[model samples]
Target: MFSFAISKSERNALFHRRETMATRMFLNGGVYSMADSGRLDARVEGLTIDPVDGRVLAVGPQCGPVAASDVLQLPAGAVIVPGLHDRHTHWLFALFANAVVLGGVKTLAEAAARIEAQLAEQATGWVVATGWNTGLLPAGLLTQSWLDSIVKGRKAIIFDQSFHGALISSTLAKEIVSKFPREAIGSYHDGVIHEQYVMLAMAWMELDDWTLKAALLQRQIIMGRVGFTRITDMGVMGFPLLHALQDIYRRGLMILPCDFAVQPWMLREDPLLSATSASVLHFQLRWLKEFADGAFGNRLACMCGHHRYSDGQGGKLLLDERRYVDDVLLARERGIDQFAIHCIGCAACEAASTAFGTVMQRLNGESSGCTFSFEHFETVHPKLIEHVARLQRAHVRIEVCSQPGFLSDLTDYTDRLAAHVMARINPYGDFRKEGLAWRAGTDGAITGDDPWGGMALAVNRGGEQTITVPEIMGTFIDAPLAVNGPATFLILDRDPFAHLEQLGQVQVLETWIEGRMVFHRRN
Candidate 1:
């Protein structure tokens, strides 16, 4: 539950305190606090329609009109909309290794130059660097010999741009391999581990809890200042980590609003554990993410034509149908509401759809209430789009991780690598026409967190579909208020990115979540 303090009036007192907890406030004058009760009330402007109670309350001019309230007026020119719901973000991983950015380095020498600088600045015994794309590297693939020479004797690890693969020094690799079982050791090929193997290997390294905590808090605050009121933390691995973060925010050290989407493995370990609570109030914990295939950069996404590009060798499937079905059924049995399957390629999407349909039948009605979401529909086939539409009609949601940066980030000399040819068949407009609740997200860290970037990429046609920015944002604006907002909300046509301009020119504008002013754009 979320609580807040407000300026109120009592018995002629100008700024009296309302200590008693209250649920709803319809005050005719002054301010009030509901932090103790964990309820919040805020008035948002710049709306085309009134979105008060999950319904379109009003549209046209009436929607944007000021409501009758005794709370302090927010002053004019401050455009407000419903807080952003970033459905996909690698928040933890990004902050953990953000300063060690390694994008845009062309050659091994350039990469070494950057790593050498990072090592000098880093105070820790262990140094980790991320965000180097092997596909875009000037010298092609980064061999272990190349990484060894750069770090010399330091315990260093360089993660590929995909974050799924890494080039580790032999010293660090040897240190990590000791904790894992025998079978997992095969990931090391000349001390370079790719995909899940890299994550497992890095987990073995020592991490200072105190230092990590401070860094995350500082990063979260910075994001909040950037107008991010709500973020979905997909990086949280377990209940403890989620609990720790929640506690930090409850102490009023909030930088941004957040909703945690725990990984599937965490839910499997503790089925009854509810990561949701009063202090960590506004949360959606039902999403269980599973990877059907790895990333495209690594050529590990399960696809029918993966072999065509990689020496006539197809990609590997990360999650088999049996494991997929088991996880889906388990979430269903526990009354969990959703599962987001990271399916990128056509084959993976079809495989995931089948697993969901199978689980739907197995769970009967009690467990079928949970929705299934297919994340990153990058290389989807035309025929599969029809099946996906059917799933949406049956309450399934699709999250298209549209990042235009990928075009520049993963260019393969020609525009026909994996999804280049199939781009025309992505069918984004088709899904919209079919009336599916489609949402866009930047896999953040991997792609920058500019919502406009995702919008521009998705709209500026490829394959067979061409959508405009107005059309995409139009659908996006309506879906969240319809599906996630409180009783009576508002949808604004004003672009959030553009609204930042109003800050210095006019008032010291801000936005409040559950009544707490979490963001105040400075002049």
Candidate 2:
């Protein structure tokens, strides 16, 4: 097997500098800039950007000197807003050409058709897909044999929407079972693997650089189309994915900024590249990622009482409480300043928080300069919320990288989770009421990477959890879109505030990263 290697010349080429220019661009529009105290600003008629470096020159009441030749007026219906930042995403597979998405399949016949079509494309090789929503079909209907029947001669694996488990066909099972640990037997189904085994399943598919290139090509088109300017990749599994991205960035193909996670699994496969920190100009390995527990759809998000997935045995923690505490210190040793732990269940959340507290206790009030981000913080028992707040006081910098898209998974939380557990599902309002740090992400594992689609979920969620359009938009933009910030933003076709109910219909006319226009909707 060929390893990903970069020569001295190639490494130097990654940072070749260019002279900066003073070219400027001016836009005349009714802009909703985060500049005015982060409140949905009054109609700002002028916006200026230094096109050379893509930094905002001026906007709203702070409009500075402008040249008449620079003004570019948008169409009458255009609505300008700050570019979206997705806090969590698996960038590699978001648009992988071969990785078919089953998020829309509503029936077994539909799923079968998709698998067969993908198999037909290749005479031999595995057909990998993800985003298999459990609500689409009866859970009993999807099994290894059921998947095998879809494409008899080919190897196949369809990962569940939750990204915590999967159903593998027999042919692929033979390839994955040998190394599969016997003690880690799965509980979801006959041939289904859950928790860390999902990583093991993906490891079976050794994607080459060529396969990855096809997927990398979709990064700009797909991400910009969905209105994202900066994406924080949750973590990528294999070496080829990161290497493929590095190659693209080397060739000046990267269109936007991304903070890629340096996952623990990558240390064994690509330690040199993983430790380098800066992979390319716009992509950096800034966050170290790990899983704390399984997810909701798998009936495995460690609950307290009898929920749908458990009777009394609340789900699972990927590691014991002691292991998590050790890992926190290990993260500090690795020089990882940012840590993202995946936790969905209340018990899982508690375990992760306690581990952070343990490390702080050992520090005795010394700051390690490391921040902790909890991914998929969908549930937390009311009592544990205060403990989390106290941990923050003790200097375990905490933030929730939440996926609002998961709200679509459950129609009525009361019907699925226990009475006590259901109320806490994505309790954003509670987080706000208690002053918790939180941000939005389109997980892409279970949902598509559409900021508007995710925002629509929050807007329509009406009740304590429902957030005003501007407040939810803040989660995507990071802060007020003030001067000197990156000239990355979007042109929506209509006013968002006026049509909050129709957010799903809002169209992105253009997406600009820096001063460059990356995506323009075809007329």
Best by lDDT: 2
> How do the residues 49-149 of candidate 2 rate in per-residue lDDT, one tens digit apiece?
88788788887533566566666778887878888888888775633467777876778888888877887776756788886766555457777788877
What is the RMSD of candidate 2?
Answer: 5.1
Query: TM-score for every candidate vs. truth?
Result: 0.72, 0.85
Minimum summed lDDT over a 10-residue window in model 2 is located at 302-311
Candidate 1 matches the true fold with a TM-score of 0.72
Off by over 4 Å in 1: 1-78, 94-98, 138-141, 178-186, 201-205, 238-243, 250-252, 255-257, 267-279, 294-316, 329-335, 395-422, 425-427, 460-464, 475-509
Clashes of each: 19, 1
User: By TM-score, how accurate is candidate 2?
Assistant: 0.85
Report how far off residue 387 is in candidate 2 (Å).
3.9
Model 1 weakest 10-residue run by lDDT? 27-36
lDDT of each: 0.50, 0.68
